[model samples]
Target: MTAGNTGRKRPTISDVARRAGVTKGAVSRALNSGTGVSTGTRERIRLAAVELGWSPSYAARALNGKPLGTIGLVVRRSPEILDFDAFFPSFLSGIESVLSGEEHATVIRFVPDAQTEAATYERLFGDRFVDGFLVTDLRVDDERPAMLHRLGAPAVVVGAPEGSSDLPTITNDAEEAIRGLVRRFADAGHRRIAHVQGDRHMLHALQRRRHWEQAMGEFGLEPGPVEHGGYTIVGGAQATERILARSGDERPTAVFYGSDLMAIGGYSVLGEAGLAIPADVAVAGFDDIPLASFASPPMTTVRSKHRALGSAGARILLDMLKGQAPPLSTVLTGELCIRDSSGDPV
Candidate 1:
């Protein structure tokens, strides 16, 4: 039988050079298209490599202090049992993109809330689990940053960690972003504004709440309507019911929802009430989701820089691991993309 039929191990660069009648350095110059190698020799080396099924030794390259190349993406949220991809695609796409420059890959995991979050690192700190961690969705009084710091693990927090001294953090200015919505509605002559906030325990919701209240008072507007959404579309819709049942004078003329998912709920409930948008009550939300512009008249809302946030966090973590002094916290501004939900500018 011919040798081609046998399951032989692949040849090496040396074998390719030998077959091509060139020195190893000449073969490398040919493969790299360096200036020295003649055109005919380059082609012969390439043919030899192909025939032998030769490949570069990435493991050898990694053995000399060069990273094997992977960044760990750690999410504190619980992993949903469903197979369907949820809100992770956007952020994951972002994380994947930023690491492309360094040829690094992300290993994503969703821990079971705070208790397990603290426990996993305890076991995995030196177990070769990851090069570094990307901590997302930081909560108020979070313990993960301190835990990572104590373990001397490099990490980048997607949201500001609680009581952190120097862990690199990348976060969107949630309060300021939402405050603009409050200001815009008040300036647009809608005084009775309502906010459908998300989970209070989370840092994001807390930031939104603090800003919503402050911005309303800044323009001399009375305390606007407020309700806890628990970050659900259904929860938001039910919260809307409570606002709708209030007295006529107390009824909100405007509403700001925490997320586009919640906005979907608020829009549905408001439509059922026969309330004409802006004519009866205006609505807005955050996280200008892909479907936001498609919602009936579109939506006037704040758009989180989720992709940038994830990308930036990953970059910071890598830098920290490299012994670079990256920013302790990186804050990015968001946009108030005006859509039909808030009505015309007037």
Candidate 2:
């Protein structure tokens, strides 16, 4: 068996140098900075390193105050909640796409609350275990950007939060998209349209709520009941139950959910109540997750490019690592997908 195949110690720089037919100094230069090394020589050294399964030691780099070539992400949510959320996985895939090309890694921490999220960042930064961070799930008056700035930690905020001028931000034009969705509902003759809002603490959820209200006012219609769904299936079901309990004259003819999961939950409750979509209570949801299309009667929703958001944040962070300053803000726009759930023909 080859040295790499054997269950022995990992290959060292010297092994890489021997494999590449280069001096130890040349190997170090190629691995560290590639300065003073020809393109062909650097490629050979990199190939040797890969073939021999040699990678720079993180502990040694930490000791020398060198970059660990990893980005940190602290999400203020439980693992279960994360698993059900469609945006994170797609976003992470985008981040991996960029990091893989640079031979970097991502350190993700899923915390239950803000305190644990803060502590995770502190530990990662104190240990120099990451070169930078990608911050997501922004809140109103978020303190993370300021905290990271104080620590001199380079970070990219995945959502635009207030008082974040010191950091780069990647955001989506969700407000406009939500407005368009509401307008579409109005055009479809949804006069008594209600909204099942996600968590009010989250900026994106609040923005969507505001957009919905604004669109209603613009269309000369009164906003219907606004239920807090907590961005979960159970929450959606509970909220739908409340809506169903309303008197016929007070009931909404259509509902707009903040997330697809909630919409699915709403669908279950609607089905149990024997209500036909669009004919009785039309439905719409946000974050066009994979399951939305396959849902019975399909689902009308906003197709936000969550993966692109992740990729943009990662790209900005990588640029920061390379001593290049990226733009202060980047905004992605999404489209509204009209489906059968909203009374659109199949």
Best by lDDT: 2
Alpha-carbon runs more than 4 Å astray in model 2: 1-9, 23-26, 34-36, 344-346
lDDT tens readout by residue for model 2, 1-346 = 7755766888888899899999999998887766879999999999999899898898887898878889999989877766798789899999999989878999988888888888899999987888899999988888999999999999998876865478888888877777877787788888899999999899889888888899899989899999999999999999999999999789999999999999999999999999998789999999999999999989999998999988889999988887787899999987789898998432
| TM-score, every prediction | 0.80, 0.92
Best by TM-score: 2
Worst 10 residues of 1 by lDDT: 78-87
lDDT at position 262, candidate 2: 96
Over 170-217, each residue of candidate 1 has an lDDT whose tens digit, in order, gives: 878767767777777876789799888888778878787777888888
TM-score of 2: 0.92
